[model samples]
Target: MRKRIGLLLGCLIIISIFTSISVSAMTAEEIIKKRDSNEYIKTAKAESEMTIVSGNRRITKTMVSYIEGDNGLTIFTNPRDRGTKFLKRDDDLWMFFPEAEDLVKISGHMLNQGMMGSDFSYQDMMESDKLTELYKFELIGEEKIEGRNCYVLEGIAIEGKKVSYYRRKSWVDKERFVGLKEELYAQSGRLLKAMKVNKVEEIEGRWYPMESVMEDKLRKGSRTEFVIKSIEFNPKIPAGTFTLENLK
Candidate 1:
């Protein structure tokens, strides 16, 4: 009987090891795809507030955004930035300033510039979440972030890809597949910025980050916080909303 019990225990141990290996074999690309698919709906609208903190000063701006597939449009509603609009379609990004009555294309070096003096750049705004197409991903390991289990992934931009961050490290929640933290790096392997998700809320059966903070590593004592005031999933958006003519 003792021999039979020992044999059973040995079999259980082997099964456990195989299970562990099977779980670890799941690729980093799968994690990114899961997170991206659940992040944004087919069509959505959001009212958000961006607060920029530099040392002791705080500047806040309110905006509304509409998104469909890879296209997005943002309109500032704050008194200071009222009438300023940003539009992104496919690979092109455009900004319109009512004060100047000019529509400027954001490209090349301008893509790296801060968006509206915030830590997030124009390229960041236009970033595509389809990691498989843009980057080669490697599963680093597992970690715990803010009391939640996470899978750490390192993504390197594929050759000939024009992505903003040449390298990125993301800590994705294991259960929800939400990114809890992320670090962005330049082509020189220099850390450029870091982002942390502070709060999350469920909207229409999907989890969404309600508040997140971004810090520009190049700037001392500077950080930006984005808060989603309200969001609607799969809302009906009028046609031509992403057109330059509609920007006027």
Candidate 2:
């Protein structure tokens, strides 16, 4: 029965297509040039701290996160939890359990659900399925963040069929290639989620985000944060760090 359900979701994925936004027509060469010459590497590390604020109330926790471009996402807790980890590779995501020997892919309608029921959409944590590949680039504008000026970009899905978003906004810092802020929207053009960088620190010689926050505006008073104590980018992480060999 589970296999059948996976097959059905796969079918739905195949059938769902979105309209494409003309990213190629934009300044591809310039974007690549900027990315290549930039200090941001192919991979990066961030220590995250999440705080939940609602109704004059707030809660907080610390976490560690890593991003490997062209590879996928991995999130773990600080001070370590027994076998508690989340890994998402491509379209499939799995959670690891300390006692289990296999990683289990998460499905069901809640696949799009926010992580751990936070305000952030699952898509907010995952790379926009259409970004970098689908959207044309333009150095449309800039903003001041952390006392540094950032490039403001607008992304449109190229051949945007099968997308969860229509148009998106980003504030990318030129020095680090990290987005300081992001906003996502739906096809009907409704605001869906917002991500903000709250703190930054220099680890070793690299400057990286020390704390980050994600809030789901559509859901009242809902949000998540990733707080970090340390981050080592390009560390010798095991190749299997993202596998789902055990899920229990």
**What are the Cα lDDT values of the candidates?**
0.91, 0.62
Global CA lDDT of candidate 2, please?
0.62
Runs of candidate 2 exceeding 4 Å displacement: 1-47, 56-82, 97-103, 128-130, 174-177, 202-206, 246-248
lDDT of 1 by residue, 131-208 (tens): 789999989999999899999999999999978789999998888888889999999989999999999787777777
State in Å the error of residue 123, model 2.
2.9
Q: Write the per-residue lDDT of candidate 2 for residues 32-121, one digit (tens) a residue.
A: 345444435456565655566655677554555555754454544534343456776766666665555555567656667866556655
Highest-scoring model, lDDT: 1
In model 1, where do residues sit more than 4 Å from their true spots?
A: 1-15
RMSD of 2: 17.3
